[model samples]
Target: MSSKYSLPLVLSFTIHIVLAGILLLGDFSSPPKPTPTSVQMEPIQAVIVEKSKVEAQINKIKKQKADDAKKLKDLEQSIAAAKAKRLNEAKRVKELERQRKKKAREKKAADIASKKAKAKANAADKIRKQKEREKKQADEAAAADAKAKRIKEENDAKKAAKKAEDLRKKKAAELKRKEQEARERAAQQKLLEQQMAEDMANRQQARRQQMMTEIGRFTALITQTIKRNLITDRSTMEGKSCKLTISLAPSGFVTNVVTGQGNRIVCEAAKTAVYKAGTLPVSKDPEIFREMRTISLTVAPDKFN
Candidate 1:
């Protein structure tokens, strides 16, 4: 029998035994007080007791005790089976709880794993996007650099062309300026030469005029002196003239005299008078003196006193 039912079964069996003992011992308990005997004179009769009937009654009591014992044994067996069934049910319930806990733990672990996988996938996607962004930026930067380089090159080319053109223009202007300067120099040189020639001609002309004036004045003095010394006979020399050439030194000393194309008497008189004067008026200036050194004169004896 299961221990759970053993105590109750034993207690029930013990209570039945105690009830049986009470019943058996109830006759031996102190006898109740004796009732008063009745005094009646009645004739007594002899009765035969049957031994088979009494034996039959004793056997019936023994059979009833055995039936009760059988019922108690059956009750103990039923209680033990019920207790065993309860223990089995409890074990079944405990096993079901264990399985439920295990399933819960596995489900929780699965959820955690799924979440971790999703997180890893998200992280990878994020990294990929970051890389794409960086690559796109790099491409944009490269394109910008190329464009800038092209623009710079174009600007440099334009600047170079402009510089060359400017240089050409500057050189052309410089050459033109030099040519103009040369022309101006030539014109100035020609002008200077012309001015110098004009100045020289003017100075020469003035010097000649002054020399002629001096020569004329000195020539008149010589003629007057020759006339004063003339020993002419006016009656024979009237309306007759002679031309005489006289030579003089720088100091007015007479050097020589010759007569030309005139009456011989008049010419002789004039030449003799010129010699008699001993000296003639001459110029002190070298140029005027050169002209006066040999001078020609015309003399006529008319109304001489």
Candidate 2:
């Protein structure tokens, strides 16, 4: 039992022990003595008086029993009041403990909820940052591709222009080469024409000189033919000299024969001998005709030998 209940039980037990000691020590050895009478003896009255004393004693004893019963009832009521007060105090303490536990549980649940909300917000922020980075990279790639394409186009245009200029220069060089070749050909042709004209003139000059030199051979031929036709009579002298001039046509026919210086008989004999030959000997060369058309002849037997 609790200390409060134990203290009340000890107090009740101590009071019971004191009441028992009082009962044990009180003297119950003789009844109350009869009230004393005067020293004169009366038998019947004395008996009656003794009986009255006994009845009075019995009445007092009954009254004492009633008082003891009321005291016992009062003690039992005090014990019940003490037990009720202890039971109410125990109930109040139990109710306070239960409220304290409930508050602790609510605080723990609220803390868990707050942590979960924070974690969700952090996840959303991370996703947004990743998307932004990806978009930035894609935009940079597109811009780079466009710039590369433009550079390639400009390079192609420059290459085409360079090719065209090179071709034009090549054509111009070819035209200049052809013109130079044509000029060379014209100069060569003019030189060839001048060389041909000089060669023709040299050939003609050589032929004229050759024909003039042949005149001596024609003179010899004429002298021999007239000597073969000599009809020398003994009357004509042997050592006489004769000179003659002969004329001829292109056909070598004697057109005229005349005596220049000699003895009369010898000159006359030479003229007759030339006529007897019917034609004088001359070169057939057209160039020699200029010398042979008219010729001079001398006949001295000593010199002609």
Best candidate, TM-score-wise? 1
Q: Estimate each model's TM-score.
A: 0.45, 0.33
**Which residue pairs clash in candidate 2?**
none
lDDT of each: 0.83, 0.79
Candidate 1 per-residue lDDT, tens place, 152-186, comes to 99999999999999999999999999999999999
Best by lDDT: 1
Model 2 CA deviation exceeding 4 Å by range? 1-198, 232-239
Global lDDT of model 1: 0.83
Over 4 Å off in model 1, which ranges?
1-165, 303-305
RMSD of 2: 58.8
lDDT of 2 at 228: 86
